[model samples]
Target chain A: MQSEFAVELRDVVKQFVTPEGNLLNAVDHVTMQIKNGEFFSMLGSSGCGKTTSLRMIAGFEWPTEGEVYIEGKPMGHTPPFQRKVNTVFQNYALFQHMTVYQNVAFGLEMEGADKNEIEKRVKRALEMVQLTGMERRKPRQLSGGQQQRVAVARALVKLPDVLLLDEPLGALDLKLRKEMQLELKALQQELGITFIYVTHDQEEALTMSDRIAVMSKGKVMQMGTPVEIYERPANRFVADFIGESNFLEGKIKSVSADEASVFVPALNAELSGVPMSKDFVNGEEVVISIRPEKIRIVDADAEKDGVFRAKVINSIYIGSDTHVFLDCNGVRLKVMEQNHISRLDPHSFYHKDQAVGVYLIPENTLVLKKEA
Target chain B: MLQRLRENKAWQGTLLALPTTLWLFVLLVIPLFLTLVVSFGRRSPDGGVIYGFSFHNYLRLIGYSTNCPAGQSACFDPLYAQILWRSLTLAFWTTVIVILLAYPLAYFIARSHPRRRNTFLMLVLVPLWTNFVIRVYAWMMLLREQGVINGVLGWIAAQFGLPFQPLQMLYTPGAVLVGMVYEFLPFMILPIFTSLEKIELPLYEAAADLGANPFRTFLRVTLPLSMPGVVAGTILVFIPVMGTFIVSDLLGGKQVILVGNLIQNQFLSARDPTFGSAASLILMIMTLIVTYFYTRKFGFGEEIITA
Candidate 1:
């Protein structure tokens, strides 16, 4: 039977000895399955093994243990040229001597494609990347974005089963990076080829990936859809990494099948939320995590059961939103309150030394078992 | 003192460059100018410069010897012309063979494991640590009629019950060519290795990702990228081989006579400094012309050359 996954890493471990002679797992025993036609991303900071995992899938690296499967075939130390996958390197490693057209035609010619076919496909691939009139320009003559497109075209002209991109847009300016992110997403969907993108930018991963695998210290922490990853992060690391979260030390007051109530010492109260990962017994120490935007600012006079009186410490206006820092029940909490007005209104914004009420919705608040 | 010099950067640079400038001007430019002046002067009766303008030396170089039996003003003699031609061909062939021999070794060292790469590069440079003439003498020891090679071959032939004869391997044009190739091989290898090593690892992976096998990658990526290094090595090897005389003198045993040997003989035994000056100027011009065209086509491969 045909496999559902375009690529699968089963208990993959890539070990490396440091220059200091310490054995380190560059990629731990991590297992993940990327489905066909999915824009899957391995996202993390540097040394997180995301790039290593991508390299293993691209066949640039081999797993020290377990196997990597591409299109239902176990890739046992297969060299990169023999594999049916192409890569867009982080540096956009275009052959400097080859022109844009030749860069795109390289794969076809290597596969022994006919001259006319190579020309036709090269032209089409350039057009797809909107680099049609730059056939004769060397890679040095093109801009970073154009060079990136050439790298993509060079890989995609082969019509591989999958395309692996390693931080392809990390070098571009912010505006161009954002534009290319959408363009790459559209291209992936249009061609319906699996794209395995590796990036350290969480926003890029969240914005483009159909599913994301957040990794740290060579281990896969969580793999889920964008909404799932952002809304229900797996643990303290994931919660702090994906976006932003406020962690308050707490202990479990009550535990249900999925929901749990944690008594936070900071607020001297209990908050209920669904447990993010495993089971939690009563009196177990936990972390009550909530995003900055999840907390609500209430009227001081409002009668809310979960409202805690707070003093506004500082407010920073960042055009789209106002960041309000409040001292609530001896814990400093940050609140990202969206601005509904067209322009900045200092009167609407909370000034320092003003009294306010802070309320945490139990559903938005998360309980993470604190690591030792 | 450094802080004071830093206040005027251009002055500091001039001060820094003073020694090399004085050295080149006194040793190189003055000698070249003197050679140019002497090339135009006539030979004195006492075998010194007569200090008179004449075109005889230049004309005589192009086969116009006035000392013919007919007492002619100018006549053709193919001896010097033949030596010049032979030198050109020898330099060209030596450079070609050295490139063919150097590229693989350079590529091997460039592709070797990083920890051992320095060791391989050192091995390539080891022969240079010996004095250049001594190195040539070492080749002579190997290529002489009863040298180690022929002795080994004769031993093998005797064991096989075949007639054993010492081959005439010494003092031939082939011996000179071998010596020339051995002497200049390192110059070519070093620059080529530098250029090949400068090609990042990602480039090879990018080629492989594009479906290029190792051979195809070498053909398309490795070969083209390393052209700068090859050009640099060619400049390093070809110019020196053209003007070099020691290997030819020691190995050729009068069988091979290049422009270098011609110039040397004219200034020394022949006692004709004017002719030597003209020949030296001609060699310099030829070397510069080739270098100009070659660099225009490729590049300086500046890193290693400047270093």
Candidate 2:
């Protein structure tokens, strides 16, 4: 029976020797399964092995210890040409010597397709990317966005079982990158091809991926749907890497089934939070993290379960949200208030040294194990 | 004063070019004009130019001889024509062999580890440090009948208890070709290596990622990208090989009478500067025509033509 996963990396590890003669694991022992027609992304900053993982899937690299399986078949030393996958490179590595038509048709020609077939498919691919009239121009003659689209068309023309994109929009400007992100998502859906994308941009992954594997160092820190990863992070690294969070170091005052009350010295009161990981014991150290946007600034006299009186340290008027810095007891927290109503009056905005109440919902506050 | 000098860009440019321009005008332009003038003159009885207009030397180069069989007014000797043709063929064969030998070595060096590449390139250039004539003499030592190669063969035959005769290797066409190949090899390698090394690694990955095997990638990407270097090396090796006489003179002995040896004989031995000047002009024209056609086809070696 064939496995359901389109690609699987079983405990794969890739090691490299730095120039200074240190053995480093570029991709640590990691395992993942990507379903067919799913848009999966490996997200991390540079040197975090995201690209290395994608390259191993593309057959440009081999697992140092384990095996990579595609369609339930082990890819043991199979070269990229023999593999049923193609990659749109980070820099749009198009053949500068070949014209756009020739570049897109390169893969089909390698497969020994006849002239009529190559021409028809190349024309169709170019049209899919909206580059129909750009066939005769060379790669250098096109703009960056156009070149990136050509790279996509070239890789997609072969209709591989899986498509790998290594930060394909990294070279484009911000505005163009956003547009390509939506276009790429729409394209992936229309074609129903499995895409293994690698990028360091967390927002891009959150925007386009069916699931994101946020990596740090050389290991997968967390892997889940975008909302799951954002709203409920697996650890401190994932929470901090995904979005801005205010972390308070504290000792567990009491432990319940899924909730823990942590005694934070900075707050001078026991704050209740849901533990992200299990095995929470009383007097154990943990960090309670609350996202900046999750905090609310209510009236000082309002009675709330997770509310504390605080003085506004500063305020910044941003269009979508107003960021208010506050000091509650001895702890500092940044509260983001969405502009639900127009604050035309000057007093409507929070001013310096104003008394306010900072509220952190027990469910929204994540109690995570403290990492060194 | 410094600001004034920098402000006049045209004057600064002229001043910077003064040394080279004066040098070329005196040493290159004046001599080339003199050679052309002397090419049209007649030969004196002595070794000086007679200074008269005639196409006798040019005509003789194409096999027309004023001094022929006594009864005939003119006849084709085919002597000068044969020498020119031999020179052309030798240069062509030498260039072809050098490229065949140089390209793989150059590619190997370019693809080697970065630290070792400099050492390999240095090895290719080490032979050039020796004098050209001395290097030709060294080839003579290896190709002579009693040379190291023949001595080894003789020793091998003696061990087998078989009688052997010393093989005549020097003063032959093959020896001349070998000597030429050895001398001009580095010239062909450097330019090819430069061009091959300039091809980015991503181009190869792109080709392989597009379903091309290693062989196809080399053919489609590596070969086309490195053509500029091959063209540059060809021009650099071909022209000099055609006009060089020391190799053919020493290694070919009396057997190889190329245009270079013929030109040298005219001025020093035959006491005919007019003929030598005409021959020199013909060699220059032949080299220019070949280069013109080659550059017109390949675009002046695509910016790496060292010459």
Candidate 3:
């Protein structure tokens, strides 16, 4: 029977011995399931166990506690060569001595494929990466981007079930990295193979991944779609990591099916219709996460239920939006407004220390669990 | 003035090269020119130079002889030809054996942990701290018929109440080869170790992830990448083994004569400076020819050193 999941990690743990003679868990009990043909990403900073998790899936490392399943088969201490998966390294580890053709054909040659079949597959692989007619060049002779393409082509030529990428675009410049991001996403869709990417860049993960697992200190913080992760984060750590959030510490007063009323001490008022991540008990401590774009500036004298008076400290007018920094009582909050009107009028922008009325939309406000 | 001097790159280059240029001219160029001039001139009766040009020395070196046997007008002596061929063969074997032994040892040291690798490298270099001749004498103590090796075997035989005779191991071609390999083994190991250590760990992972077994990864990735070191080690071991006479003199006794022995005999024992100069010129030309071909096929291994 064919399994629905392409890869599964069941409570996997990896422990390492530190130089100071202490045992440390590099991968702490991470369990995740990546669907077939899905683009799954592990997002975290360095030493956050993202790369270690990818290595376990590729069989370069075996879990210390649980098991890793590839295509529903238990992968227990299997060597990398025996596994049907490939990895695109962070450094684009192309063979320096071999020509592009030879490097791309290496896997086929190891399998003892016929000469004609190897040539056909290698040419097609190079063409897919847009490296045609450059087969005679060694890796050192090519530019960094071209070498990275060769690495991708070398891994893709094998046509494995899952492809693991460990920050493959880390070495490229910003413009090129952005371009390759789109190209990689397109390639994944065209080939319809499962991709397990590891990276610390939040924007790259948000733009390309079908589902993302935010990891910190060897533990999975949260896993969800980009919209869910950005709009309604599971906890304070997820809210703070995925994007900028102004947190207002509060206590739950009442809860319904989808919304809850939280009494925020900083604002000295009760916030109603706040989206609840999970059911909360009465008087439990929580944090209300409000995105900068969700707040709007109204007339200072307007009478609104959720409106508060604040003094603008600074305003920065970028091309598409204007960032207004304000201080309400003792708490500082940032408000982002789109530059939809008054492009050339300097009078329309908020000045320093100018009094303004801040309105918070309860629909966009999220109630998260307070982190210790 | 300082700014102008700094701006002039040509002047800076010339000033930097001045000392080494003068040193090479005085120490190397003049001696080589003198050797070339003496190779073409004639030898006087009392082992003195005669200022006259002739092709007699070159012709005699290729086997033409003036001192023919009593029945013949002219004869061909194959002594110098045989000695040159023997020296080439000995150098070739010594280089091959050294590479076989050094590559594995170098790999072991390069793959070892960082703290222990230093200790292993120091052990490889420890033998070089003693004098070269003294170390060769140490080998003599081990290889001699009545020395340590034979003495151990003889004692073992006496314990069993059996008649035993010591094997003849010293003063043979085999002993000379052992001495040459022992002296040049480090030269082979160091360069190979440098190249092997410079390889990034990710390349091995890439190879394995692309469906290559451990042995295939070594052949396809490790061996091809470390070739520059092998080339450098061969050059260092071969050139010195070609011109060394002391090892042969001590180990080969009078059985195996090489081109170095022939040249030494010409200058010291035979008192023929002209023939010795001719032999020296031939040895230099042959070494240059072999080195040229070898480097043209493989690189000069400069990348291995700099990398």
DockQ of each: 0.46, 0.42, 0.56
Q: Candidate 1 local accuracy as lDDT?
A: 0.90
B1-307: candidate 1 lDDT, tens digit per residue: 8788889899889999999999999999999999999999888878899877888787777788867777576678888878777888899999999999999999999999999999998998899999999999998888888898998999999999999888887789999999999999999999999999999999999998888889888888888889888998898999999999999999998888899999999999999999999889888987888788778756643222111
- Cα lDDT listed for each candidate: 0.90, 0.90, 0.90
Interface RMSD of each: 5.4, 4.8, 4.3
Q: Write the per-residue lDDT of candidate 3 for residues A45-97, one digit (tens) a residue.
A: 99999999999988888899999999999999999998889999999888887
**What lDDT score goes with residue B50 in model 3?**
79
Show where candidate 2 strays beyond 4 Å: A1-3, A253-257, A273-279, A316-322, A339-352, B1-22, B300-307
Candidate 2: CAPRI quality band: acceptable
Sliding window of 10 residues with minimal summed lDDT for model 3 chain B: B298-307
How well does candidate 2 score on lDDT at residue A285? 92
Error of 3 at B25 (Å): 2.4
Q: In candidate 2, how many Å is residue B158 off? A: 1.7
Higher-scoring candidate on DockQ, 1 or 3? 3
Model with the higher TM-score, candidate 2 or 3:
3
**Fraction of true contacts kept, per model?**
0.77, 0.58, 0.73
Q: List clashing residue pairs in candidate 2.
A: none
| TM-score (chain A only) for the predictions, listed in order | 0.97, 0.96, 0.97
